[model samples]
Target: MILANVTLSGCTGANSALCAGAGEGHLGGGSYRTSLTPTGNLIVAVCLGFIGTFGLTNNLLVLMLFCRYKMLRSPINLLLINISISDLLVCVLGTPFSFAASTQGRWLIGERGCMWYGFANSLFGIVSLISLAVLSYERYSTMMAPTEADSSNYYKVYLGIALSWVYSLVWTLPPLFGWSHYGPEGPGTTCSVDWTTRTANNISYIICLFVFCLVVPFLVIVFCYGKLLCAIRQVREINASVSRKREQHVLLMVMVMVICYLFCWLPYGIMALLATFGPPELVTPEASIIPSVLAKTSTVINPVIYVFMNKQFYSCFHALMCCETPRRGSSLKSSSKAIRAVTGPRRSNDFLFMVASLGQPAATVPQLGPSFEPTIDITKGPSSDINNPVVVSLVAHYDG
Candidate 1:
């Protein structure tokens, strides 16, 4: 990803005559020299630095929020936790190398370093994609079947995470095994997969890898989230009391992350595809530069999008930052007060009215006793007269 412009001054051993007319001549009038100009290096550096700092800070905040807040430890949050971890990896490992490559316009790390860098980069990228895909599927299942999906299923999420890491390893291992080559680019070398060879075999392998690893996974993410949104709409229509606002917020965040992911990687995928099948001359430094910058950008943006956009995450983050422990007793007391307010004596009839309005077939008008007792048939359906004032008195007294 490094681009360097070199201007030779006074050639060394062979071409002394070329420097004769020049104002500043070399020792033998044949000295070899070069002038390196940084193109977009500062911009790349600033972007990498900003993204790295933000990603690390935000992701760590997310992790701490999940760890510190017991109430936030839901199955859905577990998926987010995985996403944060993957994002942190990208920020820590990928961004630094990107900054160096863009600024230096050369791969100072050498061949082995480049291989390891590529492996780590590919690994984290795969983890991010798979984690997002898994998150989408989790949302789909939760929206489609909430009662069927409980806290116990979170262990399956853990298993899926383990599987994702395994899958990522499968993709990253090939380069190290010599099945593929990854190293610094030409004369003014930079670290990247050595795709500039323009060989049919190399091109085909890259095209296949891009399609399977990046493109297909993105499509899966979109499809899964689309279904989840539809299911959410259906659920909200059926049960307006369910309050899907928080889930919708989460879905929007995931969608944004997915869209950003695609935008960042799409260029890289396209470049790789083009590099494989096209002429070598077409693989210009300028052509690859933007894609490199964009791909690096994706690594750093994930944490920011997740935290700032999510309210529950923000609240938990604030609680953690303030070093405030959750007060369970106070929360329980508040819950009790809320329940009483909803189901209290004066509201008994209101509750019954709501239940009856739900169109349950077994509703009936109950016979009131002299004591004004509200008899609720838990087995059958709500009683029509359950909303009577006397019944309300009975319900309040019974609850008290």
Candidate 2:
């Protein structure tokens, strides 16, 4: 069986059946250059460069916003920070490498490097996917049971962040264990799971990956969002128009998220499945690229949906870029007061008495008694009589 290394220039030659001709090529590691047409190389490179740059810049901005502002320091924002980190890793580790490889029109990273690229790319992608699901659940928690969500027990969020990486490692590491392996796939220009291999182990690996990474996460997002919508509908006392508007707004956001997610991933998932399980010649290298680029473009789309959509986030980002204080910072406002209107007087506030009459002379009113009656002096009669009890105030009650 011939292991193929084909030139993309549409040529055939003696050195390689896939090579079209022999010529001096761009100086790579060695002098060997064959006829691989750089037909769409520049376009692919430009697009990839745009994606990498756009994703890197925006994701970094998101990370910075989350880190620099204390007001953003909530459980939901913490989850967002995890997401930003994952996407930044993708931009740093995967996107640039992929862009470079696409520019060269070949897999310049070679065999072992191919494995690393595939593994790291898959790892970050999985992490981002899981993070999105977690973000949705976090939103649902905040919207559905805000009091519980607000309470200080951040261990769950931290544990979730930790587990995302661990779960990614669980799937991506099996390649090293030889159950499934990474190698150059479509066009020999890129590397990924060796889909052409039809062994039981390879098939099993793909099945598990699809199930865990794609199916499970998809279901989690769906369930969380469904519950969120239901909770929104069940909310009482809100005006019908206001509730519908809220429901629609949330629905739009959810739809955008889900649609973009499927837009980026569905094609690739379908293509990968077809390439792995179908006839050997059914899917071609060039055809496989559509999904790859689409999937990587996800790094560009996520920040838009997650950050730019939020007006406050946009304001914070704008403030941050201008080297000014964050106008919409996360820090607690100093103007807030912990005012508890207790019925009984404490020594700290003993001097702050509620005087109800002007006829009262220089005298200290008696302290609160049973029923929280604040002893008042209505008239300047005998001090003892006046102190007996002038008037009692009614306690106020609030109801939702």
Candidate 3:
């Protein structure tokens, strides 16, 4: 949680009077030495405004798309729809208040308001993290263990989604229960975990939060994506061209999770840990606020990645928004047609691949023609009708 007021005061002779008592603001006697100028406040406002607006709009569109299209209902995409809900919560519950405060240059919401804001922020943020970890694991299992990936077991993800909310709520609610506390973090305009407090309870909560929420989730995401990549490589080793799309998709998944966690949450985690255990001066208000700002970027970045990277979602998005299918010559249309052809009318194979691909038939493959079999013998080489069938490139598409 972060909060601020009068940060728009520039160091001019006129503003000097306005800023005089501002620099002397206190959180437990530690002075607010952050040079929160009008420029900084404006920057914060603009960034928050853009992220808040665009993130909310896009995520809502995502949710609506999922709801509007019956075909979009799948276990994997259900995870994304859940994520859209979480992001929407963040936008509605957290962004407006922060944006108002940042623009107005003050924390108008009282102590109670601060707690609510912090609670919402932590709740939604943590849910997003856990949801993503679950998604990665789900994708991994669907790809590598096709047997258990059927719709019969897809109900498991919904149960996991409910538990994810509880998991986030469990950790975040301790503050309300007197195990820890919440308050304005940096500027006194936003609210969050009381990192400045050095106490047995607060420290314990912080450590446990870091371990369970950040560290554990981070490790899980890395492991799941890494394993998925290795699985695709195994496919490649058997049939080179058949695995390119799979490898790239898995690689991109790994990069998104790994990079987002490291950049968005790692700094905040480090600074929070330092606040508890390192030299007090090292975790300055200004320094700490940097990471906090970075973390908020994840809300905007996540949905964009999903829409741009996944062919299936983008198609649905395009169709929903534009009121028409992708143009016939468009790469997406070609990809869609190609994928449908590869898995064409082959219920058994498509069903198996559907589970493997997380219930989204989004992959594009080199058209293997009418002779294509639902059950190709992995033991046999390419047939004459499919002279270059072994050379046929396959894209492991994801519907999510």
Candidate 4:
């Protein structure tokens, strides 16, 4: 709800001038303060402009790649696509408003616009976070139980995606209904869940939002990736053929996952907590805006880490960029040939090892051959005849 505009009392000079627009009420009972100079706001506007442009373009490319390639439409990738969709929505619905606001040095949109921005961003951000956690769990589970990981279980992934959106919506809706509120945040140019509000209504929501949406998802990603690393270690122990370089590569990937999760979210979470509970003025507008800026970086970072890093997706992206439409069939044939080369006589056992090492499939592994039995014993280890059909086809569904 739009609050009544009170005459500026405490703010002086530029803050007073910037807040002096017609019909502009200090969102959340006139709590917002602008410390950023006009030039500072312009810099922020430029940053957000770049973020929005790159974020929109990159995510759109991901969606386009998914749409253009039937091979890319695996169950695991569906979760990745869900993340891209959320990030894309953020770019479209959330970033533009903030960009425009920064250009003006204050929020141009009113209180309702603030609420919508806060709700939409929170909802989409939570969806992206939850989807990452779910994707990690899916990867871990698929690796653990190769037999059960098949195309028939696509419904489970769809269910996970639906549940992520529902879960995010549950958290984001409370603010709209007054469990908390949305209002102008740092520099008065952006709006978010009312972080500066020091009331039971707002603090409780911030705590819950921090713990569940940010902390919990981060923990899940860590736990899942840690388990994946442990599994890779076990494979290394069972088979000496696994090189230390491969182990290092797996470790690096895990580090990247953890680092990316932290890079995108930890600062934002810290700032929110500080704003909610820290001493007065501890989270200055300038300091608070840094985290908010860092948070926006996730929209660009997520797709690069989660989707573009995949081998199959990269190949399709390369084809798309080069306009190799006619060569698409030959490329698939080459992919098949490459799969056979990797799965060939001398190093068949290495196939499963490679999957475990890389934490994903190198290429789309084909389904079980007609002549091959579906059953394979994991007890025999990576060197088992399991590589014949079971492991190969099982890991096929492990696409990102």
Top candidate (TM-score): 4
Error of 2 at 132 (Å): 0.9
| Per-residue error (Å), model 2, residue 77 | 1.2
- Model 4 compared with the native: what TM-score? 0.78
Question: What's the lDDT for candidate 2?
Answer: 0.62
| lDDT (Cα, tens digit) per residue for candidate 3, span 321-395 | 789854322221211112111222234333223212221123333354554333321211111122212222232
Clashing pairs in 4: none
Q: Write the per-residue lDDT of candidate 1 for residues 116-190, one digit (tens) a residue.
A: 776777788778777777766665554333122445456878877887788788777776765556654322223
Off by over 4 Å in 1: 1-36, 185-190, 235-255, 321-400
Clashes of 3: 11
Ranking by lDDT: 4, 3, 2, 1
Whose lDDT is higher: candidate 2's or candidate 4's? 4
Top candidate (lDDT): 4
In candidate 1 the C-alpha lDDT for residue 314 amounts to: 55
Q: Quickly count the clashes in candidate 2.
A: 5
Candidate 4, 94-172: lDDT as tens digits:
9998898888666766767877888899899999999999988887766555343455468989999999999999999
Lowest summed lDDT across 10 adjacent residues in model 2 is found at: 333-342
* Residue 109 displacement in candidate 3 (angstroms): 0.8
